[model samples]
Target: MSLQQQFEQAVTDSKALPERPDNMTLLKIYALYKQGASGDVTGERPGMMDFVARAKFDAWAELKGTAQETAMQSYIDLINSLKG
Candidate 1:
């Protein structure tokens, strides 16, 4: 399957989880997955977890004030666009 197909599958699968993920976690996971899938290894950057990644996750969580389905959908849309 194409990357776009994979992303679409991921989006559908993620949404089917019994417990929805926090929006920020979903966003960060989306970012990491995109970077990894593209061979950027940005997700593997040294200190990414301690510095930027964690911060972004925290910020998203705070900004949403709760898990936001829209944020997850946005992440899915981003991946779809990237794959296009």
Candidate 2:
């Protein structure tokens, strides 16, 4: 299958993981998904008070400069791992 097709399937599969991933894994998933679908992080980081948003933004920012295809593949791999 095409990389994009795999990525799209992974996106759907992510929602049905047998168990929820840990916080850090979830962060990685979010970051990879964002980088894959939207390319690099954008807009202002959330303020300190918005802890969850800030953490998510930070996680995504950490992937700065990652290519979209690479991120998509990473996301797909992660989702598959979670599925198992």
Candidate 3:
């Protein structure tokens, strides 16, 4: 299979991670997932009261310059590192 297919499979399998990762790692996973799936952040930022949404949005925004393929590969690498 191709690298992107492997990466996509890894992303699907990531849902089975034995334990939840730390905040930073979770943010990274979320950001990379969004980047890989959606390309870039869109729409307005969430309100302050919506902290979780805001954080996710910010995380994705940070990865604005990352290429989709790069983000997918990074996401797979991160899941492997943490799962091991």
Candidate 4:
């Protein structure tokens, strides 16, 4: 079992939880999306996401405070989900 395999298994297990993402979890997804949308993650390159997605991402980021690891894990789980 490699590190990547372990991570994938974790996300798969996490997604089956009763509460996939609480309020805080949603916020982290928004934050990551915002950073990606705003080009902050990509150095503000013009070829990033469109304006609408960026706006949505920002809105999502504003929904929670910083101390939300559970939510953050949900977001990570989501990203991992996309791998398969």
| Best prediction by TM-score | 2
Clashes of 3: 0
For model 4, the superposed segments whose C-alpha errors exceed 4 Å read 29-40, 43-84
Candidate 4 overall Cα lDDT vs. reference?
0.49
Assess candidate 1 and give its TM-score to the true structure.
0.34
Tens-digit lDDT string for candidate 1 (9-74): 766665565555566555676554444334222233335547666665444434332223444445
Reference-based lDDT, each prediction: 0.50, 0.98, 0.89, 0.49
Q: Top model by lDDT, which number? A: 2
Q: What is the TM-score (0 to 1) of candidate 2?
A: 0.98
Candidate 4 backbone collisions, by pair:
25-71, 39-44
Q: Kindly indicate the candidate among 2 and 3 with the higher lDDT.
A: 2
Q: Is candidate 1 or candidate 2 better by TM-score?
A: 2
Output the better candidate (2/4) by lDDT: 2
lDDT of 2 at 5: 98
Q: Please, what is the TM-score per model? A: 0.34, 0.98, 0.92, 0.33
lDDT of residue 50 for candidate 3: 99
lDDT of 4 at 65: 51
lDDT of 4 by residue, 1-84 (tens): 644455456555555655556554544555644433232332332325576556545555453353334444455566565445
